[model samples]
Target chain A: MTDDSIGAFRDELIDSGLVIDAGVEGLYGRTLAYEEIVSGIIALTTRTGAGDGAMAVHFPPLIPRWLLERTDYLKSFPDLTGSVHTFGGDDKRHARLLALVDGGHDWVEVLEPAEVVLRPAACHPVYPLCTGGPLPTQGRRFEVQGWCFRHEPSADPARMLCFRMHEFVYVGDPDGAGAHSELWLKRGAEMFESMGLDVDVVVANDPFFGRAGKFLAANQLDDALKLEFVSPVSSTETRTAIGSVNRHQDHFGLTFGIESADGEVAHSACFAVGVDRTALALLKRHGLDPGRWPAEVRARLWP
Target chain B: MEEEIRQILEEHGRLPVPMADLDNNADLYEAGMTSHASVNVMLALEDGFDFEFPESMLRKSTFESVSAIEAALTSLVGTPVE
Candidate 1:
């Protein structure tokens, strides 16, 4: 598929006020795109809430190291987490460094290790909370927007050092988990369909662990745990995975000991939507046309 | 170059700010810049310079003022912008 459309759509996003101007090199890096996308989801979620009790959740900007530690996040993907650290020094030392730099010295500090790592994924905390408490009824679900951080130096504006991740997490009986994923995969399709974009729902893979990631890449043809609702971004990277339905098997349930009222092992699943990516995808698919946009789609998104 | 950066920040709601406010030595954060303002400033820097602001540079001290951000950016790009 020629992605001339995605590039046009990207330009349209900047026009729609969904994206601030792409920086110096333009689309390659240093652009801002958030306002339009957030409002778009707000409109979509409101539509979903008309018949559902899906409460919106607000989480902290950063998650704790302990929260990520239990999940073996570092083991799974150490490359992404960002940590905060400070140099161990008295005011005098700090003053001295400041003095040198004031005198045109190359002032630098080695600093201590980071105390807290930034949250890379939106669902890390949700699963832990599920584990601590009893599994409620068979069909409880929740949704939230998490501000995430990544330590990538790619300098791609399409990629961000920090980004907002929207996730609808379903945890409860095993069957309920399946139901949530099934419903969202369809729901996500509907959202894209409404936007007049060509969308594909494909079984996709996560950035798996270690040397295994290379192994998984070779079989890019296979891998069932991933279901990505993909739209084209660049011709080279067509699958802009806006959302994914993940079956955590029993990994989270086992770790958190979350159980059904009847004490059966609970299951866990999540639908993660890169809200920013979705806006970008819309830009790629729909050329920034307020007048040309379907009234119903505009009403659903803008109103 | 600094004037252009300041003008961009001012237009983007880096309020209580004047065209002449962010001198080369003022500590913008200590002078009471808000986090939201910091983000806006970061956005402007990105657009103006075609640079990405790393999380490592999000500290209160980094946006201390025009000079601070310039220093941070200098280290990042490894040169002074004349």
Candidate 2:
């Protein structure tokens, strides 16, 4: 969609009292009505994946900065990653910072990089747990949910600085990983359809950064490592990716030394749902009010 | 040029198998070159050849094989010096 139309849609959302203008382009506060939809969508996801025997794991939004450095994330997406910073100086340094602030000059130099970084994806923190060991014969599965951060700020309402993600992760041999990704690819599509949203599952890639990333992105596409479930939310012409399934072929396993029962490096895959985007998509499809949604959809969600 | 390419791959490709066992057309990535290794290989090639790869040449096909790397380098820096 055109930039102007996207802004108009954001304005419409604000006028409807569904979202509050936070003054930031990509950051918004949700009303009770908007939050209710979000909660309902998350509950639906939990129910849909309940039969998978995946152990539920919850994580705070922060992880160690060293763990992020150990992976290839910095090389692939330096532009989108966010590291935490804090003012950890002596009293003299604080005085200097205040003086800089008083003079209306940049005061960022006073802050130092903290021990943690904002979690980039829901499944990221789980990788370290699987490290330095071999998985069981049946492999491992986990259901994780957390708020993820990316530095991308845009006019599009779907692209937010921070959003909640619900992910189902599997770490095992190549065949198991492949099967896990395949199973979720179908289930994700079906779940969206049952919610009354017409979605398409298509091959996709991460937005790798810079000149080197072009080739890396092509590599990912050629290997069919990623798939996205997209539907028109803010605009029909440009669809938003509401969910994705990614196959990391021994990438994390090698980085973290995670092995299979037979001692081979484990492959990993995850299917993630963007909770905020899904709520937005549902609102766009059914209406602004969730109370008036189709009986079937409401039953599936609220029940 | 082929030998030089093999040398760079040996140092940076991170392939499990020996480079001597592979043919020119063998897919480097399939042979165990990770995405992180590919970035290193790209940077080393630019340094070794003293030429920067244009954005168009930055794709998997351009570095999928020893021959593909040769072709890409030749396009960027003309015929192989060797």
Candidate 3:
């Protein structure tokens, strides 16, 4: 869609009280109506994955800086990662910081890099926690939900700087990890379809940066490592990726020294949905009011 | 070009088997080169050849084997492989 149309749609949403204007691109507040839809999508995931022996895991939006450094995410997506900063200084520096702020000068340079970074993905912290030991013989499955931060500010509402992701992470042998991703690939699509959303599972890759990143993205696509469930949240001509199934292929296991029951490096995969994006897609499809949405779709969520 | 490519692979490919045992048509990924190793190999190749790979050539097919790397380099340099 054209920029004007996208902006018009966003204005309609704001004017209708679905999304609150935060005065920042890619960062907005959601009204209760929007949050209710987000909750409904999360409920669908919880209910559908109940029979899969998944354990619920939750984390704050901040993760250790050391762990983020260990991952190759920085190498591939340096442009999109967010690192936290804080005022770690003596009283003299503190006074200077306040004076700069009072004088309308640059105060951010006085802040130091903090030990924590904004969590880039919901599943990142889980890998290191499972290290230093062998996983269960059959493997481990976790249902994790948290706010993920990516520093790509854009005019597109679908591309938020901070968003919620409800993810199912699996770690174990190659076959188990592969089976988990495959199972979710079907189940995830089915859940969205039942909720009256158009679902298309397509082979996809991360938006890697630079020339070398092109090769990495190509290799990822060549291996079919990432698959996304895209729907028309913004424009039908360019559907937004509301969810994804990704295969880590022992990258995290090798990085964190995680081992399987057989003493080999474990493989990992995750099925994750962008809860906020899904909510927007639902709003686009079913209309603004949940009470007026189709009965079958409401039944799928309310049930 | 072929020998240089093989040397770069041996240093950066992280393959389980020796590069000498593999044929020019052998798939390096199947020979145990991980995706991380591929990035290193690509960087090493750029430094060794003194030429940057174009975005179009940044693909698995371009670096799948020794012959493929040689062909890609030949095209980028616009000269016959030595």
> Among these predicted structures, which one has the highest TM-score?
2
| lDDT tens digits by residue: candidate 2, A1-303 | 688887877787889999987888788888998888888888888887898889899999998998887777899999989999999999999999999999999998999999999988889889888877789987889999989998899877888888899999999899999999989998899999999998998788778888788878887887788999998888867888999999998888888889988998888999999999998899888887789999999988888
Q: What is the TM-score of each candidate against the true structure?
A: 0.65, 0.94, 0.92
Instruction: For residues A1-303, write the lDDT of model 3, one tens digit per residue.
Output: 897767776887889898887877898898988888888899999997898888898999999998887777887899999998999899999999999999999999999999999998999888887787899898888899989999998877888899999999999999999998999999999999998999898888788988878888888888899999999886656788999999988788877888999988889999999998898888888887789999999998887
Candidate-wise lDDT, in order: 0.64, 0.88, 0.88
Arrange candidates, best lDDT first: 2, 3, 1
The segments of candidate 3 whose C-alpha lies over 4 angstroms from its true place after superposition are B1-7, B14-26, B70-82
Model 3 has an lDDT value of 0.88
Kindly report the docking quality category of candidate 3: medium
How well does candidate 3 score on lDDT at residue A150? 95
Q: Which residue pairs in candidate 2 have backbone atoms (N, alpha carbon, C) closer than 3 angstroms, thus clashing?
A: none
A1-303, model 1: which lDDT tens digit per residue?
344654555465555565554353233232334565456765675475345565567787677778777665664467776787667878888887788778887665535655576888877777666665566685456777777876664323346566678877777887887887788788878876776656789887556445423333323323265588887653335666777787664456655667765676677778777766666666555544444567776677777
The docking category that best describes candidate 2 is medium
- What tens-digit string does per-residue lDDT give for candidate 3 at B1-82? 7888899999999776899999999998777777877888999988987989888888888888888888888888767645
How displaced is residue A52 in candidate 3, in Å? Answer: 1.7
Q: Sum up the clashes in candidate 1.
A: 5
Off by over 4 Å in 1: A1-34, A96-109, A212-223, A235-237, A289-292, B1-82
Native contacts present in each candidate (fraction): 0.00, 0.68, 0.82
